[model samples]
Target chain A: MTDLPRPSAPPVSAPTPGGSNLDVLKHQFQQIWQVLAALALIYMVFFVLSEPFRSFDTLLSIFGQAAILAILACGTTVVLISGGLDLSVGSIFAVVGVIVGIVLAEYRLPVPVAVLIGLAAGALMGALNGTIQVLTKVPAFIVTLGGLTAYKGIAEILASGRDLSRFPENFQVLGSGYLVPMGIMFGVALLTGLFLTKTRLGNHAFAIGGNEEVARLSGVNVRKSRIYYYMIGGVLAATAAILEVSKLNFAMPARGQSYELFAIAAVVIGGTSLFGGRGGVGKTLIGMLIMQTIIVGLSYLGVGTSVQRIAIGIIIILAVYWDVWRRPAR
Target chain B: MTQADTATPLLRARGITKHYGAVVALDAVDLDLHAGEVLGVVGDNGAGKSTLIKALTGAISKTAGTVEMDGKDIQITTPTEAKAAGIETVYQDLALVNELSITKNMYLGREIVRDTLFGHLFGTLDFAKMDTEIRALFQKLDIRITDIYREAEAFSGGQRQAVALAKTVMFGKRIAILDEPTAALGVRESKMAMDLVRSLKDHGLSVIMITHNMQHVMNYCDRVMVLRLGRLAAVRDVADVDGDTLVGLITGAAEDKVA
Candidate 1:
């Protein structure tokens, strides 16, 4: 007994429960400074290299171009944070776009009704993915991979070898000006951020991602919450599809190909864990901007698409490597 | 300690049986807990100690059983139902989410949301209120954790144990169940855990603790229950049992004298 060490108090220098607001702000800045630094550095490099990249319009256009991907990434961020994946979001985007096109062009329905139908279809597809995964006890990676293929087929069948176009002028307004889409992107980001930080479902998402067994023991409704996360993912994908179709005035069955992987890459680049349990919508937003900046900046510098793709691939690997490197040893 | 026998047990379980396929994990075990008494449950590996606790806590379904609080039968089919009945369990794994802050882990399933419309609509957690309450709880219990906002992963083993025990104290209104609370702790931390158990008893909560350590049973528990091969082998007042005798009972070397 005498040889046993005594219990000691935590160090006095440790932060207290009543830490001041300044300390909190400082801690937040510490958490995100790396991403902010990277964004600034990339913007500076582009601004220095290309004359066209210096214009305010280039910045606005970057935001506009980022809108669709940003919207898709928001859903992926939530799903990834919950320790799940949805490879079918790209397909969901195409399916929803085709559905909206048919409703407006062929059926001549109101824009709001078409939009509602598209959103509902997307949510239903997402729910189906979650239900199958949960019920069959299949891994989400496999379940959504199957969804990716199946939903694409469904979209093609719905489109019937014809492009749906010629929407009412009001519908086109959603994607016409840079301000509208940009505003929509920011609005989606803000809402998603609030959902992650403020809601019970958001907190539960982190808990479930951190440890599914622990969350279950803590009385979290794991199955229902998981289904809800996938639903949100689906709805966001649908929203992006609707915006894209409005901008293009045509819905192609091939639309949104590979967007799922792109959105996931952007989320991973933003520092969201690919393994789940730690991330935010704000981080995803920054990640989306980083990718958009590189794509637009490279094109302005007369770089080819193949080069841009290679650069993005390298950045994704580096971002993931950084995540792994910074993780404290188990 | 003598009063424990005569005062109707705070919690009682009868004929608790659990079967998984062809294996009988728990063979109609019985348990009794008195108010303000620490009851230690001991058994060898695969001896149904955890099975019994899970059955009681509704972590696992029982093949057959009845659990009563103050002699009134209560329905417990899920962990939430068990919690609603004022029964809290600190599982062997501690069940703490490492990435979440102490405040979040403390109120993981049952958070205190704000009174505003946003809270009502979105179920917005009131972090300020939760922080204040948990801070006050730690102070009242004399637990030494200062940063309640730090993630659970950042804490030492003993500190995490403290957080888990504090959670039990906060919500275990009538009964607190702990499974191997000190298995991962050092000698000093083991003593600290026992001290916290004493505090829980002092706070007038009945406790059902499972441990492999004979010293803890002798030092802290008023009475001990031993399970052997999924069956309740013996129950003895700690004063009447020595460490060797208890080990014999656990290993099937000694006769079941008290039964």
Candidate 2:
């Protein structure tokens, strides 16, 4: 039987007059120009106000400190874009750190094995969060909010109220230098960006967030895809936790406390929508850098920690306001 | 255009029923969609119009029914299964992600990836290929948009409708189901949308459209099916029925003459 030809593969014709190379560049710049301008303006303000902030070393250290948050925020960016939240990420980080500490300090496992186990634990916790939310049809906010407290308790129980320290020399090297954590941050960011833009699941995340019922009608497995997003968030949280523990050579149950909020703040500051379906890891990187710059710069100017917190709080509000204000009325 | 095909319909649904507890939404509704023809489904509010379409397209499960394609029984309990059975639905909401580019929304669930190791392992989308093909499709369909890379939110309601229609044309094989394709558009936009609906037949695909617009039914549909109070009321060639008769059939003022 001769079947009708499917238009699945249309003949490739000449490129359209619009969307030229320059147009593409212009469009790309349009998406990021506002955030980029904000970052530059903030940096310049800091550079001019504080003499110490003008130095290259201070800038390197600011990025070095921002690296951990950047890694954690990458996962947050994915989760937010998928229209879900994982408030337990901070606890997930602490739990993974404690797991790594136990595996190395108490169990005498190899670094690679312990690292794998920690990562797995992180994924497992994330899976638990995602699975519980899916099965119960509970809002992710309530589920992860409960997990925020519960997972922290679990981590504390695992640590027995003591901080684990003094890791092997090679393990300490993983986070000791500026390059290693920064490299991991960029690598995770690159991977996260690719996952969002390149892969089918990544695209589904955006669709699901933008309008879940529509995504479902379009044959997207909303439940399954959401779980995968939470898993990515979980694994990245673990990555950040391990790096922090290695750098500090200590793992306390209190580690990564309130880091989830910081990650979210950074993601929002980077122009990612808290409501989801609109943001990228690249914007998130800039957001993280902007945040770190403000914190570090304020300290250089002899501003107290309380004042620094106020500054971050104000920035977060402004960022979200800017997002809402600029958005065309639907 | 009103001449019925005596040959087998491309898609047929029998005894499609749905119940919400004591409420009977659709009751034993039957439909036949012939090849290369537009079938308009019309009903008043709560007259089982959307429910019948939902049952046929597997958006909602039927209480009792069977759907057939090409004279063969097919099981479709979900939208994915419906699409797999050569049925695509353009939902009332259009289902376009506001933040994504037109090309991205066009290939949301079924994205084309690079045929490389990266594609195999990581499922990296080949945007260049997608861009090229979508442009070709728009050109072929005579739909013009300056940039396919613009987000869906940036487009007007009519443009988004066009994108949704284009998507159905792209992936829909034998049958395309549209749920209120122009319910949201202005007068001019609605005309454009109906024009696209008419064009769906030119592409050699059968269409089942759900609409309340009498003008659309008169202009676009080859045949019209009326649903009233959870049951199939009448099926008429658009050539035979006036707009008043369709409204009467929907409101139960006039009995189904053919029945």
Pick the lDDT winner: 1
Q: How well does each candidate superpose onto the true structure, as a TM-score?
A: 0.93, 0.93
What fraction of the native alpha-carbon contacts across the interface, defined at 8 angstroms, is recovered by model 2?
Answer: 0.39
Residue pairs of candidate 2 with colliding backbone atoms: none
Which residue pairs show collisions in model 1?
Answer: none
| Model 1 CAPRI rating | acceptable
Chain A TM-score of each candidate structure, as shown: 0.95, 0.93
Restricted to chain B, the TM-score per model reads: 0.95, 0.94
For all candidates in order, the CA lDDT equals 0.88, 0.87
The recovered share of true contacts, given per candidate in order, is: 0.44, 0.39
Put down candidate 1 lDDT per residue, B1-259, tens digits, no spaces.
3445676788989999999999999999988898778899999999999899989988888999998889899988889998999888988874588778888999999999889987888899899999888989988877777667667776666677878898999888889999988876877777777788888887778899999999999999999999999999998888888988998899887865442
- The 10-residue segment of model 2 chain A with minimum total lDDT is A2-11
| Tens-place lDDT digits, model 2, residues A93-187 | 99999999999888889999999999999899998999999999999999999999999999999999564888898899889879899988899
- Candidate 1 lDDT over A1-330, as tens digits, reads 011112353422233454456755776677778898899999999999999899999999998899989999999999999999999999999999999999999999999999999999999999999999889999999999999999999999999966599999999998787889889988998999888888899999999998887888889999999999999999999999999999999998899999999999999999998988888888888898999999999999999999999999999999999999987565
